[model samples]
Target: MTTELLTPAEMADLVGVSVDTLRYYERERLISGVGRADNGHRRYDADDVAWIRVLRCLRDTGMTIDQLRHYCDLGEQGVTTKPERLAMLRDHRAKVEARRAEIDRALELIDHKIDIYLNEAAGDAP
Candidate 1:
């Protein structure tokens, strides 16, 4: 199998995150097992990139740092942790679904007001 690796900047670009963020993740132990180049520069492999993408997704979806850390901790244990990870993801999914439902309600109200404004403009509203 061919192995792919990226420099810090390349990893950041590929992950759509800043280099500082990558360093921060490593420094904070949110990610681990990064390789070092001849010059001691950080090099990230495909696994690292994929992991960072997952981290970004979770963070973007409003997962708290402590929750994220817990998820990562469980993930570090490998397959035996699969069930725990599944449970955590399921819980997070429920929260996301609930938030989406709330947003849908707000959007429905906004659409209703827009309809009223349009009707009023067209003199269709009494």
Candidate 2:
């Protein structure tokens, strides 16, 4: 099987990020191994796309650039760094869980207020 390659625009579309964001990730070294075409345009292969997806997940989950860079660095070190990577992910997961709990609490409060209004509309008392 052959590996598929994508142009910068195609990559951005496929990854649901702007071309500028792709370029920014490249500049920040959050993702790497983008090839240059004969005309000096950037080309991304399947692996690059996979890495970009990982970067997207990390960014979406509020991972800082430095933390992402560290994670990527550990990933580049091969399976020997699995423990370190797992530790980092565990730490990040805790943060995400905490944030999720806080959002859940706020959502519960909103639902309670909505319930009050709904009950009042139904001619119910406090």
Tens-digit lDDT track of model 1 for 1-126: 649779998998887989998888777778899999889998888888888899998888888778888888887888999999999999998998998999999999999999989989999656
Model 2 lDDT per residue over 1-126, tens place: 547779988999998999999888778778877898889999898889888998898789899999998888888889999999999999999999999999999999999999989989899775
- Candidate 2: where is the Cα deviation over 4 Å? 77-80, 124-126
What would the TM-scores of all predictions be?
Answer: 0.86, 0.85
lDDT value, candidate 2, whole model: 0.89
Clashes (candidate 2): 0
TM-score of 1: 0.86
